[model samples]
Target: MGTQQTTQDKYYVVVAGDTLSGIASRFRTTVKQLQIWNNISDPNIIKVGQRLLVAKATAGEPQPGDPSFVPFPGGEWFKTLPTSPIIEMMGLRLVEEGCGAAYGFSGPGPKWNDKHRQAYACFQSALGYSGSDADGWPGRKSWDQLRVPFPEEGCDAQ
Candidate 1:
């Protein structure tokens, strides 16, 4: 009889502060595959001492630099907006033309009135402005601030 060759599966012990994405990258496998193999419903929920089965590389698998799997450099430097196309579309308009324009829909303002100023403050807060709201209306400093990850060109989108 001929001798048979056996391949043993490799396993990894999960450590504290280990994330599924981090572990999957280290093992050269996709998070989806690891989840499927181990019947994990939530990739984000992993515990220390969990045993992970490392799968062998497969054909047509995504490479490290593949667009879908690639880690964006400086990604952490920017914040992602919540998904709401309607909000994005409308919010962009409000940001562009809502409060800061001359006689815009945000309320007629050479300088905003109390109500107008309150609305402006809310808008500023929504846009992630971190400065004091005591002054209400956005000033030179507010315009210089990078709030919603988009250009704060004077609202003219009307």
Candidate 2:
């Protein structure tokens, strides 16, 4: 929005086929608000997987971009060849939770692969999710519970 950034803000990760107006409608906010919140001068310039502030955070929400706050990138994000620090952060968190013991050849790297999925499934199972819920795809609830640490200082997450 401005040089003075708001520390606490709610975020939404953009996904395929999303338009600025569509996102605004989905979040029940105005496109103008989205622009102001994200400092987006061109409404059509948003890219897939981009994170946008949808609203101001209420009490108890974590600060935006802080290590304690990680927004849920949609499940579709994992299907793609993601290379963000967030992926590595998630892998480490899963391993910490005892889900990534067999991380295959490269170990817990920054790309999405079967290893990550398998480990995530293990985490989900530990959390008591089963059937379709424990399919290794990260849902909002499971993701929030995972608590992937924010990327190290100076390392931006996608």
Model 1 has a clash total of: 2
Q: What are the per-residue Cα lDDT tens digits for candidate 2 across 70-110?
A: 67888887777688788888887776566877596566988
Off by over 4 Å in 1: 1-6, 56-158
* TM-scores, one per candidate: 0.33, 0.55
Q: Report residue 126 deviation for candidate 1 (angstroms).
A: 31
Count the clashes in each prediction.
2, 0
> What is the C-alpha local distance difference test score of each model?
0.46, 0.73
Give the per-residue lDDT digits (tens) of candidate 1, residues 1-158. Answer: 11112255567889999887667545544566578778899978999999988654334433333322213223221122223222232233333333434234643322224544454465566546756753454443333231222222322211
Top-TM-score candidate index: 2
Per-residue error (Å), model 1, residue 26: 0.3
Candidate 1 yields a Cα-based lDDT of 0.46
